[model samples]
Target: MQFDRKGLSDEDLLRFYLAILKPRMIEEKMLVLLRQGRISKWFSGIGQEAISVGAALALQPDEWVMPLHRNLGIFTTRGMPLHKLFQQWQGQKEGYSKGRERSFHFGSGEHHICGMISHLGPQLSIADGVALAHKLRREDKVSLSFTGDGGTSEGDFHEALNVSAVWDLPVIFIIENNGYGLSTPVSEQYRCESLVQRAKGYGMEGVCIDGNNLLTVYDTIKGVREYCIREQKPYLIECMTFRMRGHEEASGTKYVPPELFVQWAEKDPVKKFEEWLLLEGVLTYSHMEQVKASMKAEIESELVRAELGGPIVPVTTEELEDVYAPVPEVGTDKDIETVRQFSTSRPIRFIDAIKEGLKSGMEEHSNLVLMGQDIADYGGAFKITEGFVELFGKERVRNTPLCESAILGAALGLSLEGFKSMVEMQFADFVSVGLNQIVNNLAKIHYRWGQHADVVVRLPTGAGVGAGPFHSQSNEAWFVHTPGLKIVYPSTPEDAKGLLLASLADPNPVLFFEHKALYRSISGEVPEAYYTIPIGKARIVQEGSDLSIITYGAAVHWAKEYADQHPELSIDIVDLRSLLPLDYDAIRASVTRTGKVIVLHEDTLTGGIGGEISAWIGEHCFELLDAPVLRCASLDTPVPFNLELEKNFLAKSRLATTVDRLLRY
Candidate 1:
């Protein structure tokens, strides 16, 4: 009940009261609608409206916000149309996400609101990227994000805090430390006494506030916002309160102790604020009721409009249309246009090709940034970015903490600000720790909300080195199954450079798989000028009529070596540079030329990308076959460490035998 006005005028205080009351009223009505089978579900913020309303009011108009499901006040206060929000809740196409996602799970760029995903942690890291963009642009804007007590347990939470602290990003991480995460209590969430106290571990300042007090909440957040912009420092604010309702409408409050509810009931935020306003003579009881009635009437009007709005129109073609932004230019021969006469080209290493492409992108696009562990001064595990730190400076060539999810989220955040970012995973296997961000957030974001994650993830993949299973993994299959992600794997240096440049140009997320074994082992004729090989296109590495070998990455070398060993047996080698939108024309053309095909890859056979390619070929080119498609891939077991065992496990051991058998058949 005790608070400071913090120089806020009486008008501002009255505005905060209305802002807080509006969401509370909406939530109350939503519960009624949910029971009537109107909307799918609603996460009610009945008691926690103060934090959202206060934060929205305190932050600058240009600053961005990432809020959770329960914080509807943030959206309502930020000028999101109540009709659109209600329509969104009703699963309408006119809503923000076009009925793809419901229940406050979609972001609105117009309102500077990035809605929280179910995962709850990527948003924090993404906000870091947004702040990074502002800092780089010298816009002096900050990014704000919200999470519940349960979210602090996620690795992304720790990673986000550490990365933001290390970078000194202007981000405010607010934790609505409601007593429980779902049914679990804060007692079981973390051993720390207070969540705000943990901020010291990350080397940042933090403040805990009475979340139920509207004046205190707004004053505290306003101070933090000013501090962050003035000092360009990350800060943490723990808003201590209770979730009066269950996690959702369906989830009851049986687990909550009766005495705890009784204790919190005395501190009902809205009632207490109303009492204060009356005691301070800000308004009469009649005026307060009139104000509340007007707001209620507005909500009812919007709700009726929302109900009248039609549901998502089920158009089969429209469903497939907007999955990717600026949908990739597939199958065009972009390579031949710029670089002709390969005989006069210069030989460049595969690693150098990536470096060259990155250099070119940086020169062309001032917004492009590079981030990864040990990539700045150490030049990465493969030394692909050697001397980049001095050339590009530390800001552009950033050495991030070992946080894959955080950096990927940051890359997506950068894209929101018209900046392109390339994130490097020291090894392909490490991406497993952050696959959720890639598959869920980055992949579905464009489809869900028309936000392009213009990010190119450099995954150093494939086996054949002495690295154990953790370091060497051909996990492209995981992302191949995931839609909205562009997968590019190049064999030769020229393709690596061109494909990388093209991937950079893409608006969607691109997984640039750089074969570890081929980085230094192979060299190819690459042009110096900037050019791009069209994504989703295949190249004929060696043309012949006897049999066809379709492969990519290091396996391309293995197939060629075997072909050179046999002079009598003519072979056609097709290197599929892009895997997502498989070059069906090129795949069928090579298969038709020989009527025999051998699919070769270094990835394990089971659930490999080869299965998809072979299945497509069987479905499309079944009549063109002289023999059953032979897939020469590594065994299903873990990649071995021994050189001889690795050779036996790799496709090289099976390529010769499979090719001869197909040729003889």
Candidate 2:
């Protein structure tokens, strides 16, 4: 095939060849290290270097790149130091992820590149978010994201494409169609004639190109990037490339047909590019050989330095650190205590208090953004965000499609780009659709990379009158099991506003559960001014000595009402606002004084958070317990649709009976 420079200068063409050579040499060295037992594993993109190098050369320095695991060419092209890459592979503390991540799992914030995660397609939405933020700020930058042909089967891929197309985000979604996803071939993965064809359905332009040709790959990517940035819209490119090696060094080509391996090996991108450069007289054969020799020497020197750096020292005491971002100072001039003096004299509904807090948060932080289904013009399902569109404008108070996983994934990307996002799930039960991204990506980001996602997912949770299982669910127990997540369940308007404001200021990912049942039923004096209730602290709603009822969310209100009716019991109510970071100090003090305890929650009995609280109290306050710790939770059955059955299931009468039995025992 004839070489097509496409108006590129000789220097640019030479740089592309160098870009391909650097990663090729580095990856080859990594494989040697793997065999030497110096590195744990290596996932080489041996014949696919042109795709990453082409795309990296096309992107502007300020534009962001979200490369997949095999895109080592991106790291070298983006100016990542050879020593840092070797240190990461050697598990040294000088690595980008502080030795917590391996291989290409660590990203460089300084280079505008996000590290790769094993779960393939979620990063598309994250890239979309980065592009969206740039557009909102009227910046001219774009984002380039990569995925494999196998990743197109993931639901996140579809969601990301649809949303990016609808929003006209400036992003280029590149699919490196390397013929296999691990061991499964493209035929088994999907029925489409070509993955690029799916882009047409998303209302975006699509193209298929010869990924083996360095000049063609570079020209195609540069043109697509320019078009995306100029039109402020997304584009899809399917690079038909092949990986000459297996998925990883440990995985051999036994599953792949020998004929297919031979076919792809003959078209190695590095060899093809070098031959093209030689034919075009862009460089002499000796000059090309010199470049290869220099790259090999550099890789070897870095490997030596990495080996001498020693393994990272594990600090057991520091294991629990950096789980959450430190809470920012409450407000411009007012702290929590000072703001408390200015509390609103009149009572307001719980929903209004949340809205007020959001308004205050947005006004305080210019980077704060709100995105959810029907949250813009429709004001959301319960009208909690009513009039937000006009107040904040569509750019800040954006409405999103019903793709929960992509919505949260985008929010995570926005958070990484210095935006604090408040993402509302229309119904907390619907969070199941996006649970994979939340559990695997958002929750583990901090622990894995020392990065904090300043994002709040507002979950309208719990059961009340008629809403059945899907609409009403107390899912806090599910999140309490997850580390690196802060969970807040407020029972009153005052606490609701305070806690919501606090969550916004927190640097970690927070699950803010606003009980759907208490939106209107609960009313209290919520401060008009911004104030924060410290996380991990419990409030003593009512102080007493005889018995203690420990609860949170809507159950706190039920417990308070039960205590009010029976004055003889003299029960103390401990409202736990935070679930993950349990208020053990307050619980210890309350249990020590009362000598009897009852744990209450609206979730089912078997795996409810009540059991965790009960077990902790049993182990820590065993001697202080006047009787065995008692639990009052709904029966372990799906919430029924019939109002009568629902009432019977979570009846206050049942809770009263349980409390009465505990006191008598």
Candidate 3:
């Protein structure tokens, strides 16, 4: 097991040779299958086998690695069963993702491997999370991820590098700079002389190595692994290699200069390594041919077994019968009364309630860590985590760089390690930068592979007080359409604290939207003891029989104000606490009683969540309604900074008029 300074032991040398042969033979057989129409696609790592094989052999079994599309060598070398891998590629039900996803998009906790998204750069941030978790656990383990020459241009790559470097996380970012990203040459990707030069910008160490040489890659990764564990920091390794084939089999190599292929052909990793082994007396031509034949037979047998896997079974439920995790609703009134007897109640602001709920979760579950920009000393952009360091310490209440995607990726890694994370976005609009991580990684992770991302993204959202388009926009509707995310927008302090507890309890990712305007403007009696409001439940702020005003977030108060002013018209106010798994039963009951409804929200009219509600009302509650269902929302325009323009854009008068019109009808 010991690695020698002078050379690898004869056994290790042979083992490495076998490791390289497996993926090489497997891919060769796969290409034939692809040509035969038995397989769908292939990302050939034909010439660059040394990078994945050497990296896998260098890493300890317990250390994690996020493999790229061409890195099947890492999976095969890590002892992942060839049969299951084939089934996965065939889109069979028995595969890791159960046919929900394709190729290397699925990960295995059993093999100490995390999957990569189609967006290659996000894996770098996910690797940061796994490394961060290992560091926090005091485990001397290094987590590594791979990207290509083209992926370095992505902001995720830079964000991940800066985060790992600044936080002193143990990670190795290996760049497979294989000449071209698809058809574009290295010259077109960036102006830097070499990708390794980027390490200096993030204040990290960098090195470039000859990737075609197996022993060189093995030795370099092994050395870097040791260095990262010893120094507790990130390192960049750019494996200078060439892509021998086209990016994928479907994409031909016509764009590549023929001379480049001729040049790289002489440096083929497998054949060259085999030649070296023959010269060193470690292998003979006869033995090499025999071993290769055996490998081919092994792959053939596994392919047959994989072909036996059945098609994806049909499911009647939504999103494969288990896309979203089950989040409990509020307890019955009797149960609620019992819970209230155990806790002291006091008036609290919406902002303070959120802090208390997070603090409570952190206190109860020691594995919970809060991460955001300036959240530690400054307590977050709105001072939500202010003074949290004194209670939870800097390690638990951590300050992150201004990289939302990387932070979200880290949350995924932490979730993998059984740690819950509270990720705070400074403002709601800023979430746009991290949407790839949220929409692709976190949102799809569970549905893709039955792997839960138990993280809460605290979105300080909605508009008021003239914060303008960028600061004040309501973006909850953006994620409501996303299947895997649970959207919670609470309007009151008590609901904010209680719903947060519920969000933390759920296994899936939850988007906890906090309206900035209501943070201090609203005050309510919040329980001192830990209590959870059910995720998919609506609160009836007031009960009436003439009209029902259904809304959530800041608009809940607007409906309450209008209802209080018009005492002549009895109004039923339904505040939707959870948007994704909407409390439709409550809405049905209210609309059936009132026989008329108006969907109100501060956001613009077209494409707003109100439209969805209005449509649902017309479809399901049409017979019970006395008049046509109406939607009261702001004009289809951005939130204005001018005070008077903003007041008119909010559509408060529109709600009042809609109520009177519906009543008259």
Q: Evaluate all candidate structures by whole-model CA lDDT and list the values in order.
A: 0.88, 0.86, 0.88
The residue-by-residue lDDT of candidate 2 on 546-570, one tens digit each, is 9999999998889988888888878
**Which segments of model 3 are wrong by more than 4 Å?**
1-5, 325-337
For residues 201-320, write the lDDT of model 3, one tens digit per residue. 999999999988888899999999999999999999999888778899999899999999999889999888888888878888898889988888899999999988667776757454
TM-score versus the correct structure, for each prediction: 0.97, 0.98, 0.97
- Of the two candidates 1 and 2, the one with more favorable lDDT, higher being better, is 1
Between 2 and 3, whose TM-score is larger?
2
Model 1 lDDT tens row, 251-342: 88999999988888778888888888888888679989999899889999999988887656688777777788885553343455635543
Which pairs of residues clash in candidate 1, taking residues 3 or more apart in a chain or in different chains?
none
The TM-score that candidate 1 achieves is 0.97
Predicted model with the maximum TM-score: 2
Q: List all candidate RMSDs to the true structure.
A: 1.9, 1.5, 2.3
